[model samples]
Target: MEYVSVPTDIPDEQTPLLEVYDQIGPKSTFTQTTVNSLNLLMGMGLLSLPFAFYKLGWVLGLSLLVFFCMLACYTAYLIGKCMEFETGVGKLSSFYDIAYMAYGAPGKYFMVVLFSLELLAAAVAMLILFADSLISLVPVLTPFKPQIMIGSILLLTPLTWQKSMSKISWVSFVGVLSLIVLTVAILWDGITSPVGPGSIFDPQQTNMWPEDINQIGLGIGLLFVGLDGDQILNLGHAVFPSLYLDMIEKKRFGKSVSITYTIVAMFYSLIGACGYLMFGNEIQPEVSQNLPLVPSFNVLLNQSALSFIAINPLTKYALIVHPVNSTIEGLFNIYSDTLTILSRTFLSFLVLLIAIIFPSFYKVMGFIGAALSFMTVVIMPTACYIRLSWDSVSWWSRFAHSCIIVFGFGFMTFGTYGVMTV
Candidate 1:
């Protein structure tokens, strides 16, 4: 049996030892479906939900859904063009590769730097959310949160080290299952709960704030983080870049892209819409906390039961709580508090892992109104233009392009600091 390996560092000459490119291509039979499901599930996770819910409510959520539909439609069109080109000789694994192939070595380098920054920013945002969640869950844990986060990273690093891509994929698949189940349960409960006479479409009744225009704008800016093009771009390598091409050759590109994008858009929009209708301004930790007040889900039930067992006998009996005699929790807590220690360790690791891995915000979005904003915005379009029109490209066009990509780094240096402080 052949085995494939995904390098810790991308763009290296080391081909996977397996039949598939562990890093770039679908390795296991489970890769495609599992990864796709995870994509939607992660998109709808606790971290992303509440803010969207608070800002849009059900009405705007639907509007956002429509926007996603449009986005998918447009993306599918690009993918179709890519397929028509039959440009599958080279790897389209990362934005940089796509840019490099479409443009030149310079374009490739530009994309790498740009994407790396974006990933870093994303990582930071996740850390911020993780730290915030820890503080909310256990106030006393606040003082040690940062330490725990860092420590957890050290611990997890070894476990994740030398692990195969398939392993990572499967583990992520399992984690996503838990997250999705929790989210769906929460949303279902929220939808069933009673609501006032006002329509979910009504902004005023939905607790939306048209009064805070700046806030709305900020919310839109933040949405860009979630609507990131990286995920789609990543699909280029994992799936056939020629997937659209193959379909097109078979006269199926149009239908395939259309159906796929529509499905993805509708799914996310539905999740977001449901969550928004249920939780409004009070929504903060979008993915995790915004569920309905009813505590029926396992995680919620477990927490409630634990709380009840501590406070009152009637509530404990209602939950049918039984004290552990020699369980893991008991053994650990009997002599030392395992949950607290483990929680601290786990939360700390996630915070640091996210901070380091995801790119900075400015790197992802680039400066608004900048001429080179096009660089960060459209990978394929810019690459295609550069490739086909390199020599005949206008002097101004070249100048503008250079400015757009260059100024982004300068902006990131300053913008990152600003973001951290703010």
Candidate 2:
């Protein structure tokens, strides 16, 4: 295991590690990488943004969205910088790889466990979304929610067996477009519909601050789940190194990351604000559910939203679970195609089982965001940066890193309690 070892000598910009990364093959162009990052950043999580906004009140919600977006970008930047450290022959490519490089065997084990759990939790949430959407769209499936979930697992199991991302990239693109359409529909509906007296966007409604302390805490947890891309398993902070390595123009990798997050943040703000303004406190966990269901134009929007919700998860389910499957194969040294299929099938079934047992989408999201996202997006990167740069960096840099770590832990603690109690 080649870890990014600590250097006795100060590493300048022209270090051998930097030179090695420069020599590596660039498999993706800047545009391709940016699109991929955007896709990963915006997923089913967008569906929960409205509820998060309503919980926190409009002003606080928007502020938190911007804050978290900047935090996510900064943490990713730190991961990129840390990956430039000496890791023997090759560069540290994944979140687990960086963890191992930074903290050896213990860190590797911890990251593997966290990453696997996060992936599994995400898969479970997707299945829950699938079953809920199906039941909502097709009334006949209402009583058969359990069966629908089981069927979804069976349908997605084969797709997971396909080992290449390129095969599913088109479907991923369609999924992204579906979300965009959903966002447009939500915005359109919110603007056209009559605002109720208690609507958050209404002038008569209470301004700015949330009156309920409990709701604010819970909202923070839910907002973290909605806005934080780190909960997406394979493509969070872990993805920076791979993106950096794949870029045709290595120098522009940082700029690309910033652009990707900025675009994603804008989308989140739009959806969250629109959805919350439309429904206020009555907002559902999934924004699609909040849309009016009638026999007119609203019906068309409702069906479109539900259809996309149902289809999008199925399309991205395989890719979402890919990291865990690959990790298992690597751990057990299983190279056989047949075994790989079996492993994916079993894992998919397990995730479906969990979904069936705990079908609360927002709750699951809050739990995952608090437990896993906080560590991956905040704590891990800060810890690694401090470990690698402690002796060489300034006191102010160390103090800033320490504050981030503390903030991560504090938020995680508050989020966990909020989710559990709410």
Candidate 3:
């Protein structure tokens, strides 16, 4: 509950810009932090929920969604506790900082690898999704062959080169607005569209449950991926740590996070439940593809969805590329603006190339969600909590943490296999 002030003695050049911001920038109110957290968690993940729900059946689907939401909230709280554990020495500015404190250099190295891989995969997935969405929005681009990837890279390269999170925060706001519009559009369509015979809400629908274990496993993986918003784990632009550091009343940080997650969970539930109920088994991986395109209102809804899909990724491109940029800069000790621009440009180009090579959007999301998200969101936090509070906490807490670790590994293994095979 105690608010820590930034040490003024550190040299400006030695301090990270983010650290500097924490020191001098105006602190955000609880409301602002809540909004930022909401923006961070909401994204393209919502679009895939209906397909995930369809695979699992309504009962199991909603149950897992709520389960994961609570799990994510708990792990996030564990992260805060871990940060508190290290607060006396200095501020834990990022997840890597907490990792380093928990298990020394090896822990730091492990987090770096997991985060770097996850961000790279996410960026590749975003690029592929953007290209696919653009093609869906404008059928004429189909003839151009790879025009989407090329155009996206060219347009986004300069934007990614911008080095300041403050500079990019506006784009993040725009991305948030896009997500809000997209969410409303999807919900509106779900409400207005006539339910078919196979609707999940209709008793006449058959095969309500998953046909096999494989389908259930895939559904679980997709659901995890759909809920993961930890792309904010990138140290260069992490949301939770920033929110914690920026809170006007540090004691209320937990309350703010709880409110934000609750709102996000509600949004996910509505989108998943309503979308699945509307389309039943007919829903596409990307719900936008399943939206009606003929009626004038429907056409507007479709465009809004497509526009969000296009802009969200582009706005997020920089945040995704930031860790890579920071890594290269730190490794080579290169701090010049020219080098920063060149590095980001090269990273953007590489992401574009990879996206072109492998254009499976939802599949990639499934892989990352199942393989990496569990580790970052569940395993790591729970392990750290156990390590930091082994003697201080109750024995039951340790057992719960152990179970979570086992569940995380099991889910990752089975989920990855399901995604690969299916």
- Candidate lDDT scores, in order, read 0.40, 0.76, 0.73
Q: Say which candidate scores most in lDDT.
A: 2
> lDDT for model 1, on a 0 to 1 scale?
0.40
Lowest-scoring 10 consecutive residues by lDDT in candidate 2? 197-206
Clashes within 3 Å, all models in order: 27, 0, 0
lDDT of 2 by residue, 116-214 (tens): 888888888888888888877877777888888888887779888888877876676656677777877776665555555223344223336676777
> What is candidate 3's lDDT per residue for 1-422, written digit by digit as tens?
23457666765554554455556556888888788777667766677888888778877888888888888777777777776664444557667787777788999889877877888888888787787777778867766537777888898788777667677766666656666787777666555545452233342242356756677767877788755674533321234766776666667777877887788778889888767776666777877666643252367767977877777788788788787777767877878998888877888888878777767777777787788888888888788778878889898988988999898899888888888887
**Model 3, poorest ten-residue lDDT window?**
197-206
Candidate 1 local Cα displacement, residue 290, angstroms: 3.1
Task: Give the total clashing residue pairs for model 1.
Answer: 27
Q: Name the better of 1 and 2 by lDDT.
A: 2
Runs of candidate 1 with Cα error greater than 4 angstroms are 1-46, 56-65, 86-97, 125-143, 160-168, 195-209, 229-251, 292-422
lDDT of 1 by residue, 111-174 (tens): 5555444333333343334444444445577677556446435644343222123433333333
